[model samples]
Structure formats: C-alpha cells, structure tokens
Target: MAEQSTSAESTESRTVLSWSGGKDAAYALFELGTDDVTELLTTISENGRSSMHGVRQKLYEKQAESIGLPIRFVELPQECSNEEYESRMADVMAEYESLGIERVAFADLFLEEIREYRENQLAETNIDGYWPVWNRDTDEQIEAFLDAGFRATVVAVDGSLLDLAFAGRELDSAFLADLPENIDPCGENGEFHTFVWDGPIFDAPVSVETGEVVTREVGDGKFHYCDLW
Candidate 1:
C-alpha cells in the first residue's frame, strides 16, 4: 500500500477519490475536477472484482488510464469481516495522510448514515472527507451526466428492486424514464450500479460488450450482475 504513493506536492490541496467504477463515482470525479484529485482508490476482492460494483480490475484500470490518473487497489479476502475492512482502510488512509494528501472524496448523495460513517472514519485521521456531490438532487445529477455526453451501462441491479433485464441495458434517458418511481434516478439507494465507458473526461472510450447476466444470492438479497468484456 505504501508503494502506491508516487504523488508530489502541489499548490492546491490533493485528494484521493474512493472510486467504485460506477456512474456516481465518475460524476463525482467530474464535479470535483481532475486537478484536485490526485489518485483513484478502489477495493477489490480476491477474485479481481471490485467490492461494490463488481467491475473487473482490468476494466477499471483502463478507466483510470483513460482518465489519466494513478489508481490504487486494495485487495481483500472473499469473506472479509467489517473489522478487517476498516483496519485495512485505516492503514491506507494513514499512508495517504503521511504523503500529504489533505482529503479523501466520496460520491455519497443524501445518505446520512453513509456520510456519517465516512466522517467518523476520517475523524481518526488528519485527512478530511470531501463530498462534491453530496445532498444534491439525483435527478439533476443524472441529467447533468447525460447532458455532458457521458455514456455508461447498467452493470448490476438489485434484483429485489429492479428486473434482471435492466442489468445489461445502457444508461440513458430511456432507462431512467422507465425506472419505477420508487427507484432513485441515480441509484443512490443501491437500486442499481453502472460502468461508465465514454465521457468528456476520458481520453478514449473503453470498448466493451455486455456478455451475460448472472444472479447471485447474498444473504437474503439477490443481485443481477452483467459481465462486460
């Protein structure tokens, strides 16, 4: 983890973004601007998939490359406990703090508990947490993402809240319009997750094709994940 830092000091305060390889993370990066964010950090399972969005490590590496930023990956065991997760994250945060990173950024919107958790974690370190897209209206943010010519695909969906068919669909106005009123347009409530491929910030589009949708049962809930390659 210590080897991940190659960051040099700049006049402006530097921040590391907690990237999930999803639309919200991409939009947050856009909102925060590329100049301030020094690096992108993501947690991955032993299987080489992101912990939250299940994006492949290779694919996300491409995203970071296209965005012209260095990325750090924290690999965890398949069945990691919360205690282990926090312990590992704390070490990473401490490392960043030692490297003079003043802040860490998240893409949380309107989730009080989530924000509180992040705040509590950062309270233990010298670094502060930054939320560029916090408390904003999801509808407007989604509209802004589309208006900015960003393109993404729905890579995963909560089967309990959305149909499995939505897993492989492109994220566009039609998809949002078709979503039930109960679901947040930006999927802030974990109703769905997206993989951004093309956008204004990216140097080139990540060429990908949706392969198959596989349902996985975790605890009492089901998640439909679409494979991209």
Candidate 2:
C-alpha cells in the first residue's frame, strides 16, 4: 500500500469519500491529500447492485478491499423520488456524524446544479461537503488522471450520445482521442461512466472481465452498459 502523507494523519476531522467506483471518483481519492479517510460511501439498489454503474456488489467489495477501506452501502429501492433519496442520505449522514466523520468529499467537476444541490443538502448538517475537482478543464483533468498511472474501463455509455462500441474500452489516450467532439473528455456530462481497476491509491489491481452489452431505457433515453464481472 502507498504510504499516506503526515498532514493527512494528523488532521482531527474524520473524512469519507463519496465513492462511485468511477474514474473521476478514483482520481479524487488519489488527490485526496488526506490520510484520514474513514470509509467509502456509495448507494446501491435494494438487490445489492451499484445504483448507477450497475456493477455487482461483489466487485464493489473487491474494490473496497483493494483500496483498504470499508465501504458503507446505502441501500435504496430501484425506483425512488428525490425526497426519498434525500431522506435516506440524511440518515446515513447522521450515522457518519455519530462516527465523528465531519466531512465528505466528492469528485464533481463544473456542474453548478449538482454542486448547488449537494451544498444545499448539507447546509443544515454538521458534516460539510468537499469537491476535489471542481472547475478544472476536462481535458487536462483526464490527462492528469492517466498520467498519474490510473487504469479504468468504460462500463456505461449513453447510447444517444456515444456509440455502443465505446463501452468496455480502456480510459487511455487512444480512447480519449476517439471520443466524439460533443462528448466531454472527462465524461463530466454523463456521456460515459468508468470503473477503475488499478491506481496509485490501490494496493493491487482488481481483475474484471467485460460481459454482454445490454441496452436499457432510462427516462426518455436508452443507455448501453457494458457489464463487468
């Protein structure tokens, strides 16, 4: 395992990363600049699948083990309203507060609405919010992520915006070069989502295999997800 910085260890406030098992989140953890990470926080479906990425629970466990951190999976039903989601998250934040974690970090990049929502949600709570990669240029951000020796694969792609073939591709220079002009280099616009398998923050690589490419309708659009196992 990589040794943590002294500054991170000496801090008083316990912290947690809002882990999404994606490239941006992985890169945020790498640049976390603090060694006091208590746990990873993620949302999962009632059936135990990752809420957005749709990755299996076992893989998430493997990821946590590789990162040497326990994960808190907030379970919710497949379909939920914003109110229900917020209520469940508030409960989880209460638990974190009881555990003495006063801060939570995210990897959000230049999304005003998302940042506003997050900040507003936490405004009334003891636990504060952090955005590690707030407004950096998407191209530079992704190049830095790759240059830092992180390896990830595209696991989900918006079928409306991206070709199905883009799914399961590694997040490397070649892949970035191939992205359409409309897609964000860091996929900040939800054009794609990734799963990090190896990185500076991990003790070892998580082995995974790509499964079938399946399309599913979400709201008014359809998405093609490359399942990983």
Candidate 3:
C-alpha cells in the first residue's frame, strides 16, 4: 500500500466507482485515491451474486467493510436485457446526481467499446465518467499491482482460454509466468477475474476461504468459477 499524502487537492470531485469485486476494480480504486471516492457500486443478479464475477453479496459486503467505503448494489433480474440494464443504471445515476456526485469511475484498461458505452450512459445524466487507469500496458499494470503489495486470487476463468486449475490460484508472478502468450497479464481480455483480498486500498485483508470450483455453461461457452467464502 502506498502512503497517501495528507495534502489536499483543490480539484477533486465526488466520484463513485464501479466495483466488480475484482482485481482491476480494486486497483482502479487504489489509483483513484479513496479520498474523493464516495462509494463503490456493484450490480447484483437475482441469484445474489455479482454480475460477472459470481461473487456472493455477503463477500462483497465484507469487502466494503474492509475497504472502509459504503457500497450500493444495483439489482438486476436474471438474463437482463441491455435496455433494462441501461434504464436501471440511469436511475442509479440520477440518485447519485441528487446526492451531488459529479463522476463515476470504471476500471476499463483498453476496451474502447466498453469505455464508449460507459461515457454515453453517463452523458444522459449530470454525472461524468472517470477512468483512473486507462490505456496503460496490461503487463506493467499487473507488475505494479503486485509491486504495490496488492494480493488477489483468481476466482473465475474463461475455460476456453485457460484450464480449470487457474481458477483458484493467487495472482502472483509465478501465475503470470505460466500464462500463455495470448493471455493478458492483467486478464484485461477477460481470460480470468480475481478477488482482491489485501492491498493498499484496504484497511485490512478480507478473510476468505476458497471452496469448490464448478464449471457452468453460459450461452455458448463454459466458465470455471471458484467458490469463495
């Protein structure tokens, strides 16, 4: 964890971060500096799990407690359509606008279409979009994350890109060294997703135990998800 300077900046705006309970989101929050961030926002499915990571709501609540930030969960029905998702998110943004929040941050690395979509969504409301770590080299970002003492575990893996064995491993140098050349070091291309347990942004480590790894079939592909509790 990097030591934060007590000096105040005059240009800081109240920002809310899109939290996925994953490494990139944690690292983005760390990069954004928590002083200006007002809350962490996550989308939860009807099954009580995070949207894509499949993390339990209870674990995310624990994460928020350890990170010393309030969190807001946007509930979505199973197999929500894009229009419905947008409408719900617009409502959330309106609520944030009412609270005087000026920006919403995301952890997008180099996904141009994703960023564009986020920006377009925010454009409809008074709040603007913020990207703390954007267009940076994925390899450097991953190295910097580890070098800064951020510890995370791989909790979800795209079975098509990686083996099931990679689902529950820690995100460390050894893991990086073993990754195939096509895989992004930071998993920026969705090769995998991680749960950050300890880092500079956290007041303390989130205590969790890895459970069973299960393979689930989604539309056309299979995903390996490691249960964490």
Candidate 4:
C-alpha cells in the first residue's frame, strides 16, 4: 500500500488533495510527497454520474489509480447553484471533520476570488486551505511543470479560443509557447482544461487519443472539451 501522509506524526492531522481530475490537482500532488500526504482524494458532484466540473466520475477514479492515491467519494446533483454548491461543500466538510481532517491541499494556479472563497469556506469548517501553487505566474509555472517531465493534453477548452484539434495533444514546451494569445497558456482563466498524461509524479504515462470536442454553453460563452480516451 502507498504510505500515508507525514503532515503530522500523530497520524491524525491528515491532509487531502482536492482532485479535479485535471492538471492542477496532478501538479499539486506532484509537489507533495506521498508519505507527506495522509490521503489524496477528490470531491465530485455525481448527479447523473456527471461531475460538477462536467467530467466523468469513473475517469477520476482511474486517475486516482494512476497516481496511486485513494479517492473519497463526495457526490452532488447536477446544475447546482451557488447556494446549493455551498450547502454541498458544507456537508463534505462535515464528513472531513468527522474524519479528523485538518488540512486540505488545492491545486489552483492563480486566482484571487477563487482562492479567497476556498479560504473563507474552509474557515467555517475549521479546516485550513493549502494552495501549493498559489500566486505563481501561470505561464512560468506551466512551463516549469512541463519541463519537469510533466505531460498533459488539452482535455477541455473554451470553444472561442481553442478547438478540438488541441484535445489529447501532448502538452510540451512547444505547445505551451505556441498557444494562441486568445487562450491562456496555463488555462487559469478557464480558457482551457488539461489532463496530465506524463510527469515525474506518475508511475507511467496515460495513453489517449482525442475523441471529440464538445461544448457546454454558459451565458454568451462556451466551455469546449476534447473527448479523450
């Protein structure tokens, strides 16, 4: 079995990484040594087996396997509004509290409001939010992560700035430098989302091919996703 965390010698102060089944979560887990982390898991919305982030749940389970981490289940219904989302989060934190969890790690690249929101939410639950890659410039950080042997593919994107051609394409330095100015190279602003295929943090690379590009519309914008498998 993989070793637990070293966050506290007491074995009670367990720290968890919030898995998004994306590059940020993978990157954060990469930063933390397995032994230094009590457990790595994800919180997902499972209404209709669809994730709140619009990904598949089983995909996250597969991802957890790749990282050799176990994921705890947190499911919610679909199309949850802000109030509903907060309620769902509170319930999840309640479970965490029951598990004696005190620290949780997040993989947010660079966002002020999101970070602040996480901090505020965790504060109410007596849990501390740890942002491993907070405030770092997204481009530099993405490049460094890639140079460190991290590999990724464009799993999803905003249709306006990107297209299906980017899906499942290897996220290398060349790809980073060549990204169109319209899209955030780091995808910090939700211009795109990526799934890591290889990294120093992985036991092996995940082989996949682009399937299709689907778009999810929200207001005047749309979230474009490259189906990969």
Best by TM-score: 1
TM-score computed on alpha carbons, candidate 3: 0.93
User: Runs in model 4 with CA error above 4 Å?
Assistant: 1-13, 45-54
lDDT of every predicted structure (CA atoms) = 0.87, 0.83, 0.85, 0.68
lDDT per residue, candidate 1, 22-60, as tens digits?
A: 888998999888877898988889888876677798998
Model 3 has a clash total of 0
Per-model TM-score versus the true fold: 0.95, 0.92, 0.93, 0.84
Clashes of 4: 4
Worst 10 residues of 2 by lDDT: 1-10
Tens digit of per-residue lDDT, candidate 2, span 111-185: 999999999988888998998888989989999999999999898899999999999899899999999898999
How many clashes (backbone N, Cα, C below 3 Å) per candidate?
0, 0, 0, 4
Give a tens-digit lDDT track for model 3, residues 1-229: 1011112223345888888888889989988888778888888888888767888988988888888777888888879899989888888787677778888899999999999999888887888898899998998899889998999989999999999999999999999999999999988888999999999998999999999999998669988999999
Give the top-scoring candidate (lDDT): 1
Task: Supply the global lDDT for candidate 2.
Answer: 0.83
Q: What ranking of all candidate models by lDDT puts the best one first?
A: 1, 3, 2, 4
* lDDT, residue 20, candidate 4: 71
Model 4 steric clash pairs: 5-37, 5-38, 6-36, 157-224
Query: What's the C-alpha lDDT at position 198 in model 4?
Result: 72
